[model samples]
Target: MSRVRIFGIGSSSGDDQAGWLTIDALLAAGLQCDDAMVIEKLDRPGANLIPLLDNTAWVILVDAMQGSGPAGRIQRFDQKDWPRYTKGLSTHGFGVIDALSLARELGRLPSRIDLYRIEIGSANPGEQAGDDIQAAAQQLARCIAADLIATLLQA
Candidate 1:
């Protein structure tokens, strides 16, 4: 059995509808907590992300990305393709590369780490993103869910 874990690193207050859409997508894809899992942060920062990563064979993260690229553009990443990132990859407290590196060092990382990232045009200075960004993030969530289903069917 393939154990798939999906983590939304931020909260609804910060992530807004993107967080809920992620949960919906997974369930809509007919995936249960037994086959997959989600971390919806309600009152904390970086909540439950580590524990979720610890038990899975594969982790597909859906996060809102900030860039000059077109909105709703979806991109993917694996450990093999992750670049040596600098100061500005994610708006979250921890950089994406650093988070993955920390998980790896702590032996909490999954065997396969895939990122389904969406590029956004604008975002709020704080935790929450702008409306356009949030919409794109939701679309990316759906795409990731579909990708997950396709992967399972192929396997």
Candidate 2:
């Protein structure tokens, strides 16, 4: 079984792509799948995200969030904090929180889940993420990498 599974969820629009960019940042920084961990980028997966949670011991979700704070500010949320942070985290009609709720209802949720929300300045179509958002993504990737390393060491 995978020790950890990280999913970067987002769309092609500007800042909304924060999640995907974070995933890219991780890859660029030399993080890769091994027996202990796996990473994937999901394009607005919505309800589709539920099945992907199965059997992972730990899960990390990365996504863009707006109105939560200043652009480029990153916030971390665990499963218990989802309801309070639901706003502006979704670029799709159905979002990460929705998927998690469904997973919980179905008893498919992992024992542990960590969500990283990258505050976005704009999610305009056909545009790339702003500099601040990109920097946040890179920063978040480093943080997650460190957390994973720590977890692996403990294991």
Candidates in order, TM-scores: namely: 0.69, 0.95
Please list the C-alpha lDDT of all candidates, in the order they appear.
0.59, 0.89
- What's model 2's overall lDDT? 0.89
| Model 1 misplaced stretches (Cα beyond 4 Å) | 12-20, 28-30, 35-48, 84-88, 125-138
- lDDT at residue 15 of model 2 (Cα atoms): 93
lDDT digits (tens) for residues 64-122 of candidate 2: 87775899989998877887778665677788899999999999999989998988888
Winner by lDDT: 2
lDDT of 1 by residue, 9-81 (tens): 4444444334445555556657567545543422223533566577677777766555656655666777766
